[model samples]
Target chain A: MKPEEHQRRFENTDTLINEPIMAVDITRYCDWLAIMFYYGAAHLVDKHYAMRKRPFHPDNHSQRVDESRRLKRGNVVYKEFLLLYNAGLNARYEPIFYDQEDVKELKESYDAIKSILLTA
Target chain B: MESTLALSQSYKGLIADSILNILPYTLAKDQSNLLETPWGRHMGDGSYYTYNLLESVRQSIVDIPWWTIGESNNMSQDTCETELLDRLINGLLAFATTEKVIISQREESIAFWVVSSALDIMTQKKYCYFFADIVDKEFDTEYIFDFRIVSPSNRDLKRIPTDAQVYVRR
Candidate 1:
């Protein structure tokens, strides 16, 4: 996808993240929150590598974030991205691993990542 | 400059012991067959082997998927192995430090996933270094663990008490 398309998706996902918690337990969807934030950052970062004729598409969570790390070496986003990625994985796989407090910390990381990647 | 001195086998062993002692669960029960050979996955027309650590049955812990080693030059393999190991250690340590507690005790025995990569193959050196101190166990998901990354040299490793239980995963 073009950088503009990626930016659009990143902005859309940000809107979803900002949606207020209602009767539907937002805490239960904490995993999705982290996952969504990660993909938002992933797409934004993908703009850099997507220019290649044969662009790399990651197969798994690690591969996805690892690609971002490889492309943006020495960037704070790599560290924050891994934290969010791991949070999503742990929440999905590890039985009862999701803690609201932990996700809150990761949300801070997501904001930091967005400030870095989403800016012009 | 920080010493890039290679860690000896004994140091790795002790580090592994420390992790096992503090953490409630193990990676796998005697994963002898796991690391016997490198795993091969069909990347494109040909097979490619990676020194990648994988998740185990215990969730996100390291498990080597033993498959036939594919053709790759020794020089490239060595370089790849070194780079992968360094990345894993740095990433894991970063994750550990970010969270207040390294390992949390779950009501259902949720295992903490830790990955270790061998430094030297010729010397049969296995396991990566990590520090673990079990702080609390009574409450659910409230265990506090103190983890520190030691340099390649053994001099920096804080001595765990001899009486501290050491569980060796080999």
Candidate 2:
């Protein structure tokens, strides 16, 4: 991929992290809420993937989290990353509704992952 | 020179047939207007099911549709599950905006999780959701149900392989 391509990808990822995140109005939309969170966090993983010369798998949620956990093993960062990962998965898959608390956790996880991506 | 394709409304609604009257919903005001019993459980916008919409769904199952949901795939296309599934979603949407609900993004796995959970609740069957995308998605924007399990809460998430189950920590 060219540098311009990389820039475009990052731009796309940036939208994922920022847009609907600001638009989170109801718990019913949490499914989409979770998808946005996962896509944003996946970008953070992209940086690590590049560092290790691994081909980036940006759309695979479980793979990114597993690799993040393995790379950041024995660290507090992985826990936070996992929180966002689970929230995103739940929002997408489960019939169970997300409450105020779940949405708050999603915001926090997105923030943590965003901090890493912004610096990357 | 046109074919008038013949069709029959075969599948009878047991749940809808069973329902007598919709439990009256009152829009009350805390600050903004709220449902007399605000919907919860991912259907309504809020968290806890203070009025628990599922119970309402259970009650809304029509007492008599004056017809029966067909048992086989022969006559009508709708299955019992799909029939109940429609009611459940409509029940949930009764409180949402009148605007149409369009799924702009594709999350096949997650959508399966939602449908199965509702099926489990309605049928009272504990179908463990093994992680396999065996079901097919016929279109770019379609929800297809497949087998899989997601724990209500992730008490032992780390103990279970992430590949095995979807754990939603309560």
Candidate 3:
């Protein structure tokens, strides 16, 4: 598959994986999801830039860095995929609160990233 | 002079609003007037008094609204990344060349690195400016403002500073 096509497939898969983690009563799962979402997004950007041989827009890059820092400082930045990296470390795991508002925020973040990818 | 005053005033409001939106709560009572520039008069309590004066005229023209809008294209994640990489490469290439390539990829790369490094330090310092929460008390609570006014003549990304102004409670 072409690079763009490959990226789209990965995005679709990532979104699917992210869906269950955002549901209510899955708070414990959120830390993991947030980590995955961040790294996945970063990797996506990295791959795109490496293939295209261009630097990311400053605004987008700044935003990514910001998000990355948020996860890291929250004490959840981790390597393992399943474990709540920061949450596990801090022992602040709470029951998931997957409501329409939370879901909407997730969707918005996903949509923004997707839109940037599609257009770039 | 009147226009400049108005523009400056408008920008101050924009900056304050932007901060409020991103910050967890309202700015502290003392730090509320942090946006006032030296040229603008400080009217105690976060308000400003404006005076219009025409300085030596160099050149002036009213902005015209262009009706033409560019067509939208569907971009993919990779494409966006590629675009960013290309810009970086271009800037780098400019830096490597003589005769002023005018793009300065090297400078752009350097700036990016600087900002990234600063961000790392800030993170270590527990100073959250962009995505920091208000509840966590570690570093002195201060609002750092950094924005660029991009114009056609100065499109080079390197010139824009990452940490514009670090504001503390006055």
Candidate 4:
């Protein structure tokens, strides 16, 4: 809830999405993919909330992404958030393996949002 | 200012593309009215509209299981799309009107799934909407899709009928 705590969590998630995600390969790593994707997204949202000095609540993630986009009133970032949110949902809920092509798509979405986050 | 406007347009286009991606195309019977291929997953062998784009979405949400851990056969890339088309036809019978409805899907998860009641619209020659699920999160809050989505070119909007009217259900 503290601002420093939120900052640490944000750094931690930024590392989670970037570093740990690279460990996943074409063979079998979907469970981690889905969890980290959702966490990465949720933490980005938490970063938004933390900027406003609000505690993070971990529910209705789609709502959070949309709301945060509205909060910042940014354009390209909204689509990035949408990609992350939707991709996260697919990764989390589905019981399928994310192939090379899938990871490529995830990487595109991940890169878009992560770049925006790092600069922010 | 120009950069801001361009990004705004880009966001809206992506929004529309996402909406169009998960949707089914109403088969214009006899193939007399339209071209065959808008690309494989966009329109099918001229008979079926490309409903299952790379196995991420389905023609009928009825086939999409409520639980994530269902059987694996449907998840395969090679899963026959005709199976999804068949489910849509069977599912259409529940409605009184025959208008076949479809949704757009470019993303991994679409919160809004529009089911057309399109047969009745075409047959009776009218626009109609029902049960905009606003209050209940357990159900659908998908807004009544304007004719913009169903018209010929998803981008051009050249042939959309002018007499569209919404008949909101009580």
Candidate 5:
């Protein structure tokens, strides 16, 4: 299944219960579900970069990389995906609060990521 | 030089005071309760240690003397100039530790919600609200939190109210 599809499924699962116990369980499940989506998106970017035989270092600043060569192989989109993935990870593991608003933000990020993967 | 040193020390003290006051309620209790952690040896509830650290840094900055330029009588070149400002900003940011603190607090809140829900279910009550102390292992802090049901209903008080304690760590 597509990463978007899986993410949607996970989101749906979160809405399946009215019970507090169920809600707690679903919350934990959704947190992990989001992480899975990040992994999927990161892998897609890595694979696309590799297929084009592009020599790119993920750690290097984009400005340092030769833009002319990197842009030809869709490095920009992949780089964007990596940043979003990192943000999602931060939301998950960092000692910060993730409210409904944060969840909405993550959903938007996932949508953008999936779009990039699909077009690439 | 002495006056500058005093001013620097004052700013540091202000920042440390802010951290102690703002962060306790802001951070997860489990995360803030350093006494329970292995690193607990380094922290204390009082402000003395933090104050001393800030004072030392400030003093170092104030002790530096730079050459005064021509026609700038109001300004004296001292160590505690731009570098001091940068250090103050950085020090506050470091103390904020917003991400780690907030995340730990949220986890505690979630756990509180779950436990409150379970109690409601076990009692077969339509709704319930609870306040309890919870700890976050990651942040080594403790908090007394209020967890309430989103939905409300009428239920009788059949028995004398008794307090319950729940602990969640993973």
Candidate 6:
């Protein structure tokens, strides 16, 4: 996908991060929130890579992460992207729910990734 | 045929030796009678459920050092174990060299041990599979490890192995 398309997808779901606490059960939404944060971060990574003249489109999450680790700003991307991937995996597969605190921590990672990749 | 047989023997020896090393750890963790667990049933009938090679590959992990996952909120033991296992696998895979690494499954729990005949047998490799019915059967079930990423999709066995060379200390 084009960098613009990837960025648009990220921004589209990025809006869900602010879903009204009163409207829905935050606990139930924890999984959704984590996944949104993970993919949001993922899209940012994809966008940054896409902007390269020789685009890097990793076919899978692991590939995306492994390839991103070799990027110029690999250290930040590697750590934050991995944390998001694991958090999203746990939320979706394991019976674990992201408490508000866990979600908040994940959001910090997302923001860090956004600040770095969005600027790049 | 002789070469194939030799290769098979070598693989079993590697697996059995690896299990023997981690057996004490599992026992120390009070993971006895692992054959009694539901996962034990999945492992196989208790035909070879002893300290011997065929019987010793039952328990996947033992003595997990549990730490709090989230602050002020203690996660359940299951969650804690799962998280730690995830970390351990990820760490091992990330740092692992593409050597002859073995992945063993004990019921639902899984462990990875990087074994090389070139290394001293006494130089421990910290990976285990306990409660074995048949070494061949269990080996058939095991996945070859490198440092493949665990994604939701693309779970093909062939593509799973990544270049792993982790030296996890005891």
Best by lDDT: 6
- List the candidates' TM-scores in order: 0.43, 0.37, 0.27, 0.39, 0.30, 0.48
DockQ, candidate 2, comes to: 0.04
Task: Name the top TM-score candidate.
Answer: 6
Give fnat, all candidates: 0.00, 0.02, 0.00, 0.00, 0.00, 0.00
Q: How close to the true structure is residue B54 of candidate 6, measured as C-alpha lDDT?
A: 28
lDDT per residue for candidate 1 within A1-120, as digits (tens), equals 776777788788777877785112456676677677667777777765565587765555545554554443324655566556555544454433444655576677778767766553
- Give lDDT tens digits, candidate 2, residues B1-170: 01101111222333332221222332232335554444544434554464454345644433322222222212222355334434432332232221111111123322223222232221211121111111111122133322222443433333432222111111
Q: Write the per-residue lDDT of candidate 1 for residues B1-170, one digit (tens) a residue.
A: 01221331234334434444433323332365443233445355332333121223223222311111111111122444335333433344344222211121223222233322211111111111221101111222222222222222323222433222121122
Candidate 2 accuracy as lDDT: 0.40
lDDT of 5 by residue, B36-99 (tens): 3332234566434544454455445334331111111112324544343233223222321111
What TM-score should be assigned to candidate 4? 0.39
Docking quality level of the chain pair in candidate 1: incorrect
Could you tell me the TM-score of chain A in candidate 3? Answer: 0.43
For model 6 the TM-score comes to 0.48
Global lDDT scores for all candidate models: 0.41, 0.40, 0.32, 0.39, 0.33, 0.48
Candidate 2 global TM-score: 0.37
lDDT string for model 6 (A1-120, tens) is: 999999999898777676575122355576777788889888888888898989989877756754555555655666566667656755565444455666666677778878878777
Residue B169, model 4: lDDT of 14
Docking quality (DockQ) for each candidate: 0.01, 0.04, 0.02, 0.01, 0.03, 0.03
Lowest lDDT 10-residue stretch of candidate 1 chain B: B66-75
Give the alpha carbon lDDT tens digit for every residue of A55-120 in model 5.
433443222111212333333343333334434444454433444444444445455655665465
Decide which is better by TM-score, 3 or 5.
Answer: 5
lDDT of 3: 0.32
lDDT score at residue B116, model 6, on the 0-100 scale: 24
lDDT (Cα, tens digit) per residue for candidate 3, span A48-68: 544544443325433333323
**Docking category for candidate 4?**
incorrect
